[model samples]
Target: MKNLLVILFSQALVNNFMLARILGTCPFIGVSQQVETATGMSLAVVFVMTMASAISWLVQHLILNPLNMGYLQTVAFILVIAALVQLIEMLLKKNSPGLYKALGIYLPLITTNCAVLGVAIVNIGAGYSFVESAVSGAAGGLGWGLAIIVFAAIRERQQLAPIPKAMQGFPLALVTTGLLAMAFLGFSGFNVAKFVGM
Candidate 1:
């Protein structure tokens, strides 16, 4: 339990895919104009990333490694993540039309989100077990969700704040994101692995 919690905390905060590694910025910026939409996207990401990581781990250990087809890791992971994104898309459209409409093209863009693929690859590289991969994936998604929601909330408020015209839109967002990244960088000194007994 402690190990799992440490992994969750480290992945979700210390090494966030969005604020720390800077992956999946497109969807982060596009769908983060509102908290509600960001929440929906985050939930979808959580599902896709978790399932992709678990399935990809199985594929690597059981199929690819066994058949000496390790060269196809990227392609195999892409297929798995793409399939998961498609499933999420259909389910969202069926159950939450409003959110589906709000997410718009960004929902489909999740298929190409590097963060999803990165998590799978990282899990393999780290030699994490199946459960750890799943947890890392979920934590990565949650980290992304946390960043996007916070960014969106700030942008929403910034629209009402008095600011120079030059730094009003994307510029302000860029600066804010940079600062957010800097803040996350502070976690790099925390020695998460040591804390987790790894």
Candidate 2:
């Protein structure tokens, strides 16, 4: 239990997919203009990532390894992720047309979000068990959501603050993101395994 908690925290903070690993920057920057949109995108990513990790883990162990088709891991993972994004898109379109429209291209872009694939690959590379992969996926997603939402909040606030002409818009955002990433780097020294008595 302690180990699981440590894994969750490590993924969500110490090794965040967005702020730490820097996997899914497109959506992190493009869809983070508003907190509501960021929240929705985060939820979608969380759902898809968790499901993808579990399914990919199963496929890796049950089919790929047995068939000696490890080379197909990337293609197989992309297929699974793309399918999951489509399903989420349909559900969102049916239930929340507003959010669907707000998300626009970024919603579909989740299919290609490197963070999703990165987590799946990381799970496999780390030799994590089924439950560990799922937890890591969920934690990674949460980390992404947390970073984007916080960034959005900061950007929202920045709207009111006076800024130099040269640092307006994307320039300012990039600087802020860099600073935030540096801040997150502080967690690198944390040792989750030792904390959890591993």
Q: Which candidate is the best by TM-score?
A: 2
lDDT scores of the candidates, listed in order: 0.91, 0.94
Misplaced by over 4 Å in model 1 are 193-198
lDDT score, residue 164, model 1?
100
Summarize candidate 1's per-residue lDDT along 96-159 as a digit string, tens digits: 9999999999998998999999989999999999999999999999998899989889888888
TM-score to true structure, per model: 0.95, 0.97
Worst 10 residues of 1 by lDDT: 189-198
| Clashing residue pairs found in predicted model 2 | none
Best by lDDT: 2
- lDDT for 75 (candidate 1): 99
Residue 137 error, candidate 2, Å = 0.4
Clashes of each: 0, 0
Judge candidate 1 at residue 196 and give its lDDT: 68
In candidate 2, residue 135 scores what lDDT?
A: 95
> Once all C-alphas are superposed, what RMSD does model 2 give against the true structure?
1.1
> After TM-score superposition, what is the CA distance of residue 37 in candidate 2 from its true location, in Å?
0.5
Off by over 4 Å in 2: none
